[model samples]
Target: MAVSRRKFISGSGLVAASVAAFPHIARPADAAATRSGQKPSKIIHLVADGMSLATLSMADQLAHLSRKRGLAWLNLHRRAGAHHGLMDMRSLSSLVTDSSAASSSWGSGSRIVNGTVNILPDGRELTTLYELFGQAGWKRGLVTTTEITHATPAGFATKGLKREAAESIATQYLDRGVEVLLGGGRKFFDKTKRKDKRDVYTEYRVKDYALLNESADLAAAPLDKRWLGTFAASHLPFTVDHTHDTKLAKSIPTLAAMTQRALEKLARHERFILQVEGGRVDHGCHMNDAAAAFFDQIAFDEALEVCLEFQRQHADTLLVITTDHSTGNPGLNGTGLRYGLSPLLFSNLLEVKASFSEILKKLSPPEERDKKPEPVTDPAKIAAIIKEAIGYEITPRRAKLLVPFIKKEGEPIYNLMNTLTCQLGQLMANYTGVGWTSGAHTSDYVPISAIGPGAERFAGFIQNTDVFRHYTNLAGIDFRNPESPLVGAVSPDSGILSPHWMA
Candidate 1:
C-alpha cells in the first residue's frame, strides 16, 4: 500500500493547477442565496502584514522548490475550491499605508490617516469590527506574531490616537471584551516594564482571565476561562532566531500555536470572530531581512494550514487570508552570473545562527567609564563571526570594511549592525535571485484568498474598505445606518466611502 510521490501529487492536483478553479467555485450548501436564515457563525480573518505580491510569489516558489507544494493560501485556490482576488490597500492620507491605517480600513470600515487607529480625521471614533462583532453576540479574539497591541491587532478592537501608545491599546483590549488575546508585548503588561507602573497582567488575572506566559502554561490553560498569553517581552523573537535557539524553542510558541489556542478558546462560543496575523513579516521587510521575512512567511502559511483544518470541521466558518499592504517589493533578480541561480542558496538562511542584533551585542562589550575601547583590528575575527552566524565567507573587500569600524564610546551600534545585515541579505538574495526595493510600504494591490461560506463574495478587484462591508454583511451586523455619525458620503472620484456611509 505504498503510494508514490507522483501519484500523491497528482491526486492532490497540486502541480499544473491554475489558481482559480472557476467551475468548482460554487458549492450549493455554501451559497448565500440558498441559505434560509443561518449565518456564518465564525469569521477567521488572517493578515500577512506587509506581504507584497512579490513576497507571496517568492514564498510560493520556494515552497514548491523545497517541498513540491506551494503555500497553503495559494494551494487553497489550486487544490481546494477557494476564491482569489486582488485588493487595493490605501490609507486616507496617502497611497502607501502604515499598518494602523491599513488595518483600520477593515476594522472601522473607515479610512483613517496613517498611525491613528479607528479614529477619523475629524476626531470621531468609529465602531471597530471586533466591537461590532462582540455586540452581535460573537466572541472575539486576536492572535499575532507582533505585540498584541501593535497597529494591526489593536485596530480590530481599540481606538488609539497613535500606534505608539501601545500601553493604552493594551488597556483598551480589556475594556473591549476581547476574550482571547495572545502575542508578545509583556512590557505593556508587566508592572516593572510599563511606563505607568500598571500591573496589567494582575488586572487581567483579577478580571478572571487565565493569564499565561510560557508555552506550557498556554498549552495547559483551561478552555473555559478567557486566555491572555505573552511569551516575550517585546514582539516574539523573529521565527528565524527563535527556532534555532534551544531555550526559546522551549519557551516561545510559534504563530501557529497561538492561532490554534485562540481558535480553541473562541470557538467554544456559538459565534466568534478571530484575527490571526503574521505581524513579523512586516518587521522583516522593514529591516530588509529577506531570511527573516521568508521564514516568517513560511510560519504564517503554516498557521493557515491550522485554520484550514479547523474549517474542514466547521464548514460554517468563513476564512479570509490577505495582507494589509505590500512592503519591500522583494523580487527575484539575476545575480550577475549569467543565467546562474540556485534556490538551494536560500538554504544558507537556516545556517544564520544569530540575528545581526545578537551579533552586534557580542561584538561590543560593556564599556568602561572614561576609557575608549580598542577598535577591532582583526579581519579574521570579523570573517569568523560572519561564517559562524550566517555560513557566508566574507570577501576580502567586505572584511577590510568591517575591521576599521570600532565601537567608540557613546556611539550606537545600530547603524553598523543594520548595514551589515542588509548587506548579508542582499548577498543571500543575489545568490538566490532575490532583490528588494527600499524598505518601505508600496502602493500595490495584495492578493486576497478565501474559503468556506460567503467566501465567493471576496472575488475580483475590490477596495480595502469593501472587505469591511463584506465581513459585516456576512456576520449579520447592520453596519449601515444613516443616522449614525460614523456614516458619511462616498467620494465619486476616488471611490473611497466615508465612514458614515449607509446602505
Candidate 2:
C-alpha cells in the first residue's frame, strides 16, 4: 500500500534543513509488532484541528467551569493504559503548517507544500491513507465539522492539486471506495453551485450511497449502505451558536452524534479506518472567537467519549487524538487582579448566544455601494447587541472606540466586525486571562494521545509524518514498499496510471 511516487519533498529551506538534520524521532517498533499478526480491527483518528496545548487547557478549563467535570480528552492521561506525546506539525514548505500540508504529512507519510494535499511541489501524487486502507480490505470513512472536501479530511481520501478545488475533491469521493463521508460543503456538490454543474449527490446515490442532509437522516441511515451526509451549505454551525438555536440544533447533528453513527456503520466491517475531525476549532481560532472555539473543543471531547466507549467494548481498536497545528496561539495570561486565574472568567462563554460572524451579518450595514447609506444604528443598541452575542459588556469608552466604524458610510462590514470581535476578545482576556497571538497557525508543537494496541509507538516526541509510519505499521501495511502495485493511483509526474497496473 506504499505510495509509488518519486518522493522529492517540497518545502522551505528551514524545513528541508530540519529534515536533513534530525531524520527520525524514533522509527515505530510496530513493524515488528505487525509481524506478530495482531492488528487492530479499527483505527479511529480524531483531530481537534488547530489546537495547541493552551487550547487544550482552555477547553478543559471551560468544561470544568461550566460542568463540574473534566473533559474525556483532558482526563485521558489518568487512564491506566494511555500514551501521550507532542508531535511536530511543521510542513515541508513552512515551519507553521496549514491544514493541507499538516494532513498531507500524516496521509502520505511525506511532507508536502503548505497548501497542497499529498501533491508534492514537484507535482508528484502520493497514495493517501484512505486508498491504502481501502485497497487492503479496510472500510474507510471521514467526519468533520468542516467541509467533507476540506484539506484535513480530503487529505486522507483523494489527491487534490489545490486545496480550494473543493468541487473536484467532492467528485473524487464519489467513487473513492469510502464507506462513510459526512460534513458540510453542500455547495460543492450542488449542481447549480458546482463549477462543472455535475450533480454529485445524484452521482453518489447512483453508487448506492445513502445521502443525508439533516440530523434525522444521519440518525436513521441504515448501516448496510455507504453514507454521505452534508449538513450545511458551508462549514457546520459553530457549536456555541448551534447549542443555543433550536432550529439549528434540530437540523444539524453534533460531532459526537456523527462520530457515533460512523462508528456504528464501520463496526460492521472486519476492519475500518474512520477519521473524525473537530474542524471548526481551527475556523474559530482563525476568527479569534473564543466562545466558538472552546465550545467546539468540548464537542470534540464529547466525540472522544464515544470513541472511548467503543474502545471499552472492542479491545482491538486504536483511538488516536491529536491536532494538525496550533492556531492563534491562545493562552491564559496572568491577570493583575488575581493571584491565580479564575474559572468564573470563562463561565461567561456560556452566555454567548451567537457567533461573532452571525452577529455581524445581522447587524452590519449593507454592502451595496450605490444606495445611500441609512442612518447609523444607535451606539447603545450596538453595545447591547455585542453584549448579547458574546457576553462582553461594552462600556461607554469601548462603545466610543466602535462608533466611527459603525457610522462610517463606505467601510466594508467585515472591517467593522473584526474590530468589534478583537475589542471583545481583549475585554474577555482582561477578565478571563485568555489571550491569542495571531489569527494564523503557529510553529508550536501539537499533542498526540492514543490508547489500545500499538499505542505505545505514539508516545514521546515524533514528527507529524510519523503518524503515517506508525499507523501503517500497526495495520501491517507496508507503506515504505515502493514496488507495490496500486489500482486507480495516478503517477505524480505523468498524471496517468501505468498501463500495466491498469490491466
Candidate 3:
C-alpha cells in the first residue's frame, strides 16, 4: 500500500513521541551512584572512523534485522546517562577534514594541515595528548583495525610532517613509550619490509614490549609488560571477508578482542588513556562497499559494547564514542512503489559474503605475456562472480556497463567518482537500495556520544579542538599547544585533489 506524505510524517512523530515517553534514562538513585562530578581515572575514546548519521542508522536497522536488537551506541543513548551531541570536524586546511587533521585537532588542541599530524604549517611541533598524558604519569594505548601507525592512531602519540610516513610513525610510537599498540602494519616493524632495513621488532623487544603476531598471542600476553601486536601486513580485512575465511578468522582477532586486551593491559596502570578505532570503516566507505562498511560498523558496535561493560564496572572511567568525520554519505534510498521494497532490498545486505575488494580480486586479468584477457570483459562471467560474492544476480545489461570501467578503459560514467569499486558499489545499489553520495569525506557535523565523568563537557555543539581541552581538564593537566596563524597558510583547496582513501 502507498502511504501518503502526511501519514508518514505523522507516523514518524508518533515514533519519536514513544521514544521520549519511554523511561530510557536511569533512575535518580542510579544517577546519584555514578561518579559524574569526579575526575576520571581512565578515558576510553572509541571512534567509528568515517561513519555518518545515515551509516549509524543503517547499522541499527541491520542489527534489528539480523540480531533482533539495536546498536549498543543507540542503546546507550536510550538507557545510559550518555551525553549526545554533534561536533564540527573541520581541519585547518579544509572544511571537510581528513583523518590526520581531524585527529590532530583533538590530539594537539590545535588544527594542522590535512596531511600532517601534530605539526603546524610553519614547522612548529605541537605536543600530542598522549605525550602530555604520558608526562603526567598516565599510560597510553592505541588499538585500531588499520595500521597501528595510521593517521587516527598516530595523531594521539606522534609528530610527523607527513601522515604517509608509516615507518616513521611506528618509530615514534616506540620512542614515545605508548604502553600498548595493537593493529596491522606488520611491514612498518619488520626489517624485511622497511626501506631502511630497520628491525623495529628488535627495538621494541629490547624495550620489553611483547611483540604479538596472532590472535592466540593476545590471550597469553602478560599483563605486566607492554604490547605491540600486528596481525596483518596492512589494514585488517573487512569483517565480512574475515568471517567467511576460516584461516583468517582464526589468525586475526576481531576489533572487540583487541579492545578487550588493550583495556586489560591499560587498566593495570595507575591511570591510562586508550583510543579504540574501527579504522576499516573509512576504507569500506572509501570503496563505497555497503556490506563491508556496515559489517565493520557492527564490529565497532561490538567493541563499544565491551567498553560499555567496562564503564559499568569502573565508574571512574570516562568513555567517549564518536567518529572523526562522515564519509561517502551512504543511505538507504526508497525503491519500488511508494518505497515498499526498500526494507526488503536493504535486507539483501545480510546475504553479502564478500567485499567489493574481494570481488575485484576475482576479476583480475589472467596472467599473460603482454596480452589482455577476455574474462574481465565477459558480462556472463562478471554477473556470475557478482552473484557468488553478494548473492545478487545482476542483469547482463548491467554487467555489460561495468566492462569498460572494470578494464580501466575510460571514464564512461561517474566522471569524478570513476573507479571500479565505486562503479560496482553503484551497480550493487540497484539490488540493495543502498546508495552513496560520493566516495569521499563530507563536511557534515558527525555525532558524539559519551558517558561517565567529563561527558557533560561534550554535550553540545563544539569544535573538534575542544576535545583536547576537556581531556586535559579531566586529567588535571593544564597546558596548551601553540597554534599557527592563518596568514600565509596554504589555501584550503591546495591539497583537495589528494587521494580520498588516504584518510
Highest TM-score against the true fold, candidate? 3
Better of 1 and 2 by lDDT: 2
Tens-place lDDT digits, model 3, residues 231-293: 999999998888777788789988888887787777667688999999999889988899899
Model 2 C-alpha lDDT versus the unseen true structure:
0.75
Cα lDDT of model 3 overall?
0.84
Candidates in order: C-alpha RMSD to true structure:
8.3, 12.6, 7.4
Q: TM-score per candidate, in order?
A: 0.82, 0.83, 0.91
User: What tens digits encode model 1's per-residue C-alpha lDDT throughout 357-376?
Assistant: 55555454446888846545
Per-residue lDDT of 17 in model 1: 22
| Model 2 misplacement above 4 A | 1-37, 365-378, 403-420, 481-503
In candidate 2 the C-alpha lDDT for residue 453 amounts to 76
Higher lDDT: candidate 1 or 3? Answer: 3
**TM-score of model 3 relative to the true fold?**
0.91
How large an RMSD does model 3 have? 7.4
State the displacement of the C-alpha of residue 175, model 3, in Å, after optimal TM-score superposition. 0.3
lDDT of each: 0.73, 0.75, 0.84
Clashes per candidate, residues 3 or more apart or on different chains: 6, 2, 0
